[model samples]
Target chain A: MPSNDKLFAYNLGEIVPLSEARLHISDLSVQRGYGVFDFVKVQQGIPLFLDDYLDRFYQSAQLMHLEVPLSREELKQVIADLTERNQLPEAGMKIILTGGYSEDGFTPMNPNLLISQLPLTLPSDEKVAKGIPIMTHDYVREVPEVKTINYSMGIRLLQEQKAVGAEEVLYAKNGIVSEFPRCNFFLVTHDNTVVTPAKNILKGITRKNVLLLAGRRYKTEVRDIRLEEVLQAKECFLTSTTKRVLPIVRVDDVLISDGLPGEVSLQLLQDLKDLEEAQMTSPKV
Target chain B: MPSNDKLFAYNLGEIVPLSEARLHISDLSVQRGYGVFDFVKVQQGIPLFLDDYLDRFYQSAQLMHLEVPLSREELKQVIADLTERNQLPEAGMKIILTGGYSEDGFTPMNPNLLISQLPLTLPSDEKVAKGIPIMTHDYVREVPEVKTINYSMGIRLLQEQKAVGAEEVLYAKNGIVSEFPRCNFFLVTHDNTVVTPAKNILKGITRKNVLLLAGRRYKTEVRDIRLEEVLQAKECFLTSTTKRVLPIVRVDDVLISDGLPGEVSLQLLQDLKDLEEAQMTSPKV
Candidate 1:
């Protein structure tokens, strides 16, 4: 067993070693891939945006019709317990609620919940500054607003994406740009306005915070973004739990205005870090 | 433990009790819902259409980039061993191959193979004669050709479908009829021509056999089917491993023709049974 196997996880109602966190083969998560998940970043023993993540997690479960077995306060307590047990200040907490084991493989039954905390390493300053390349695929996710455990298309395209040195795949449909596989996309227009696709996206907590920060200094527009507009944008960036605010230097082979991370994206990243620092240092409610 | 917990299943490479067959939460199937599966019907100790089912299973795994750890012959042996151990004459065998345990939770690692045999009870004669009602939903499956474990949309709509007395949901996108949640849709025109959707379908083994049998007596067309045409269809039915050639009498609020099992569908169902009987009686290939 690996050393990380010693790490603890919340399985069903019991806290067990990560290695022992197992699910039956009949689970819809295994049988029909029917489940929803949410990730929360743990910074210095603090689960960042816990309320927001929990709200989205419960909403996702509701959309998928998999009732979360725990109440809001109970779930928060579980997360708090897991955080203390794992003893990892800098980590990611993955909460999964699956359509439980069904007598027949097709029906949704009592839900099974599993929560695990794992080491999370954010992008280095140099890498974030240099930015990453992403490839666009003409596809749209189903039930885009809900963060379900359905990432087959993105995971399947990993090989093809890696072949071109792209770190992510941006989903687009009918020439309209959407979100990336795991992150939300943002564009800085030539007029310095912030634009991001409004529909068909799993609105990320980081993206929400970034939008809040960007709103303070720039005119932010949430609407459909065209691929052509993206190509002509002054800057591009993605926001996620782990990728707080990473710049995107290139989309496919086209450079995002001068083939470098733009000033606006860099400024947003710094602002996001400042916001995080404030949240981490502020007194709890 | 449940009484069925005593049943055996093949997990990874070991044959274990079904209750003991579990996967780690880190598996892509659990974390990302990345996997493919195929079901085969077994009768009288023989797996019907084993070759065709195996071919499709491998094809699904290939399309999902999940390498089936066992070769064709090895898989056949595993199925045979499972059949012998389970000692059930009438059953459904599920073959699942998943993007295995990944370190990053997004990457596809070494695949996991799970084979399990479960008791299968086909629809009663009265149920088949009366036919089942299905609701039409404005949706299309992602990667419809591959038999992936992604059935979130279908399963989530179960309650709504049941609320309207629908046994299944027929997915139609932009007025184009594709397929049912877990079966293939077919129609018989007023002129006696048999038609089934050619694109965006799983192409079930039972559908293939029924099409072959129908072709022997009727003009068969494999092409796009529209919702407008289905309402005018002389007969409507579905084909699946367990369903065989079950008729569809009522589609939403509209009934197909006289709202009774059409002669053409009943004839095809009989033909399919005849074929199955012959296969069960024939010597091993």
Candidate 2:
């Protein structure tokens, strides 16, 4: 059954019933997945990682040659207006830009946009504190760096990992670890080095912050990592806007750090928490 | 310069200015390219290949595990309502279904729908009658059968083809010829046989009809054809809802039919027209 609860959604240029926000059948973005967008968590009525997310989003759009008519400042205002209208404190915000409708009927011309606030249920306190288990799969994001709407395989990978009783999936191609479907994958080596896949992953905002914090305390390297290296890691973790710093206690039945969150993982989690708390107390921009 | 004249567009269930329809930034479809949709042509105020197009569209949604809240009948009615509202005589219709806002703050629970129509100009008479040149690229659709929004590479391929003065780009994978970015590829072999890629291509409605008619008069095979085989063909053609059956006079720089529209290509085009006329004039189902 579909959810009938009302939602405040912005379609085109007006606020409308969530049920009525529809896209045309011929939209190139919808028809061929020819669009790019960004997602930011709204914490205490403020959007986190807004600029970073938009920067990456626009980069992907530029790569695809999708004309984003709105200036960066204008888009920020649109997002701020959307969040204010929705009155969502701790929710998710989405901005979509399609290749728009074309007059020639073949190529896309105008871009389509929609913004909305989503209901969010955070992970239980116990799960968040104790961390979560994860599984590694030999799946790769087709365009690992860019956030685009072509994630059928990624979705399937997530489902498969969930079915196996894991919280997330860390994907690798040809035994070279790539990244998680919705998060960035990182590992700590025996030599006290923190490593992640160089650019074959989304340049996640949360992940970036984590990397910055880690660099201050430990030797950090951004390089290609093999499955063998991941399997031998002393600790593993995933990072995302929502996930923050989540430790992977086990991968594909193999225990990492004696099947418990490693010290390094816990340290990173605490660091991320401190960062979030600081942001929460900081003055509004 | 961008076109200043805008066409009327249906946004979220309401008719709106073509420049206004927009999607959210946090939508999983836009953020991760996790959505499905369909497109078809409207001719003489009627959507051509409506049923076939919708069927394939929903099939794509099914593959992605997206639920179309509207039933087939309900959706048809909605599309009809949309077209009537737009009052488009010959246009392009688009339908986009995105995984809606989710409670998890990461994944969505519902799907968003958007429908719109754009005033479209039909193919130029000279190009339709005389056919066009095409370029061959060794690229493969990541997921060959289902048409998803992962079209960055496809669009890039098209731009690359056009740069060399070609109208379309014929794709090949490991020496095997695939379809065009938005059309199905066909070839008339030296043995006078008509062939297309067996599967791995969009089951285009127009392509199916053309194959059926062509098979009635000639030995037609839907089997894998190598790039070498296609390059050695006597005549080549491409098919889509918009182009119908268009001859490929050249591939790269090699002449297909003395660098002109061949007899076989001309015959297939005529056959396609006859089939369309027959279907349109038939009594109501």
Candidate 3:
């Protein structure tokens, strides 16, 4: 069992044992939906793409009228300390800031800061090689800019898709393809142009990197990708902090071009892998 | 500060310090809004209407596809022990059940159970006597059947309303009266008939009791009351577990019948008080 033996969390101001990082039942973050968070992967003792992820986190907090309790530099130091305390070279770090303890059920005064890491074992080479299936759901991510704690719709939709053996749930509104509940969706049009939903989806760090890398290496276009067009795309894929560029060979029982990873998706996945490898092995800064 | 200093909470079958009753940061309850809860008031060292609250809690858990980690009897015992440990003669008790920690962030196992209490000072007679003015916001409660943690709309609307100098926010969807973000909305028509919106409102415990009490006393009517009609109602009121029955003398700057508590609202409030006073003070077996 990969347990907290190797897990250390930054609670409030200090890096502490994971067991000590607890939330009082009175916290509005728990009683009400008043918290924001971000997850970044670590490799070779370095937080991958920290700057971009932090920017998104701050954007989300601003939308919620929550001030980041710590300065960006202070937060960065804490992340570094958290990594040092956990003694991990490769893991996934989640930074959660909750509108902390409040006797007033709806009004929160204290803000909680919790940073923890978990072991990461990316999918086997074969799983990524064959690509994965996705199911569509009709649910809009509220405060999509901020990684808010209230993710009931996303979680339930994911569970329903997983129950039917799908890898993800592609959420849509008004028959237009939004993005996966947790990942960003992209498609390669027949004209060899790569397409993705507009910024309405989570401005995922990995999604941004994938787009930049793909544009640098191949022809691409980011726009309002409709569901009907997505169903007929030459290739479909998803991007996330953890799953960098995963191919979506099937969307709901519809075979995405003979149920195989599209040529463009495979190339983009390789490009993202190359980018990650360069960053992970980049000289210490 | 009115703290429940003696309040003990049950954390995984062990009685722990009230302050130490905590859940892991990754608990789905906090990570995702995949948790359900119940809040009930304790009066004179006894949990008031606990059975009814617990029944609703279980129903909420089931609706969220979560299993209450304890048997009904076990939960009751935990509640009893929790109340005893807290030594709270009168306080607010809440039970939170989250589909516990998970690696995949989707599938959860070993749901976490948290119980805590805090001294709640009910509004003074002076405040209730003056009644509360409210503003209407276009919003609707999600998963009205289950007390899920995804209450951002409810909490945010209330906060926004408060910013505008309103004590509460009444939500309406498509001109139909929904509910107050935190409480249930009720009105007394000009004909001495009590009425409230039937659908899309939390079947609040206090609302149920008030309805029953009104039916027994004033022939209350339960129907879909539109927002316009509610705003123009001769008398308006709100109900919640803690508030019991509070008069809404004003809505959106409009005085509800000369900005005074309506005759029917006043009658129902008295009826609710009598019922609360009639409840047995002794702990039930």
Candidate 4:
């Protein structure tokens, strides 16, 4: 039992203290790193784009062959319950489904569902305005579409990223650019054309919303973006649940168009904020 | 507290029941799948080639930027204590070091170490004698040299492997065969030369021992092995702690030679047994 002040989490159908939400050693998430997870942002006691996140969450689970124990409606109810119990309006909700305790530590048996809410702090306005530098590495994620718990490569490169003063890694393969480790990347060409890689990315909800919003105003294209074109782009930015249209001013040693936040990126950020505000006020049914 | 009959595991600095060894949901192993693990085979109360396994384990942790909390000698003592407490003459020992409870669920913090001894059942002699069929996929593991807990791709392909009547997956990039999901691949060429992939592999301890044993009697080469060469090989096999030298009779729909276990594979299996016997009697210090 924990104090009432402790944060609560939905753990395998039970609302328990976050500290008490533990998994046994036999779970494949711990043993084999076999699991998929999706994150949603909650604001003003409302989950933003919950349906979109849920849709991708189930798709990722299906691709990974993990069966979600609860139906979509039941999962929504659990999230609502957790949100009410935790009482954290501005928090991040993580829905994780893992290959359950295995007898041989290889096979996926009964799956385990763990939903946790934690405080999420977005980048400061000053940081977002200045943007961040990114390092490009020639690599590709395995099962790029499935949001599995496998981030070993990106995590392993943290030291190198820090050494080079780069905050994120943009993956590229065979001269074509993909997404950042945790975010979808978009670049504005010199002619103000917005482009993003269509293949080999974990189509982020924020990216989706940004694409929709940007499509209404800008000429958008989802195709293979080469590294050479990224350097030539007038503006560049990344999108994710945590980083909603955050700009990338530099790629490696090269500055992205004078190393300043581009007009298109800043506008898209405002557009995403407007969308979030509307969703928060209306409260999706 | 656990009953005396329960299996014991070394969690962090303390020894506890295996079932009681649990990690919070915030662990990177669960949150981000950021960790590395090495498996060792214990024969008659002795962990075979423990130094080799530990060397590789440390290498893996280093590559992943994970600082192992215990020194090599301390880890050896923990393994010895676990072996004594479990009283299992023949078993598999798993050493897992995960990015500990992260404050943000993304970064690696104080690593958590979990050491557990589990009952291991090797493939029956009959099964090994007849060998198994494997399906080759055009995929490569991220960080192929590190034994990280990122087997999601292989695990996801389990259903397809079963449908195709293949016991394991042989991963290849382009047309070059790297290794199996959990083993190092080897092939006896038509000219009776032993060959294995030199790059992009975990370099299994069993593979190391087999290479040394086989080199004594056969011409051996460690270089890039292509799928065409594998299909035309006189013999094909895989080596791991659990499967010392199990034969692979077929790759996808193509059978190797007569689709039967070859003589060289059988001889190497005998050689591996002899080496294990020596290791069991004369434990490395």
Candidate 4 CAPRI level: medium
Give one digit per residue, the lDDT tens place, for model 2 in A1-285: 115346677777777766567554455654566676677888777787677878987897777667677888988887777777777668777777777765443476777776766755555557765767877776666566777666667664555666888888788878898888778989999887888888578888988999999998899999999888887899888888777888777788777767777788778888987877777677243
Which regions in candidate 3 have their CA more than 4 angstroms from the true location? A217-225, A280-285, B1-3, B85-87, B104-106, B157-159, B217-221, B281-285
Error of 1 at A173 (Å): 0.4
Give candidate 2 regions above 4 Å deviation.
A1-32, A41-51, A67-96, A104-106, A110-125, A135-138, A156-162, A275-285, B1-34, B39-55, B70-125, B136-138, B156-162, B253-257, B283-285
Measured with C-alpha atoms, the lDDT of residue B186 in candidate 1 is: 96
lDDT by residue for model 4 (A1-285), tens: 123247999887799888789898889999999999999998867899999999999999999888999999999999999899888758899999999988788999999999999877888999988999999999988888989989988888899999999999999999899888899999999888889999999888898899899899989999999999999889999999988989999999999989999999999999999999999888663
* Share of true Cα-Cα contacts across chains kept by each model: 0.74, 0.30, 0.49, 0.70
Could you tell me the C-alpha RMSD of candidate 4 in Å?
2.1
lDDT of 1 at B42: 93
lDDT of 1 at A122: 95
**Model 4: what TM-score for its first chain?**
0.97
Clashes of 2: 43
Flag the better candidate by DockQ, 3 or 4. 4
DockQ for all models:
0.69, 0.24, 0.46, 0.57
Q: What are the lDDT scores of the predictions, listed in order?
A: 0.92, 0.74, 0.78, 0.91
Q: Write the per-residue lDDT of candidate 3 for residues A1-285, one digit (tens) a residue.
A: 126665778877777777667677667676776788899998878898788888988887776667788999999998888887777767888887777776666776667777888877776779888999888887667556668887777665555776889888888877878787678999988887888888567888888888898898678777776788888988899998778788889887788878888788888888878888887787232
Model 1 residue runs over 4 Å out of place are A1-3, A283-285, B1-3, B283-285
Kindly give the stretch of ten consecutive residues in candidate 4 chain B with the minimal lDDT sum: B1-10
lDDT of each residue in A34-153, candidate 1, tens digit only: 999999999888988788999999999998888999999999898889898888869999999999988899899999999999999999989987999999999999999999999989
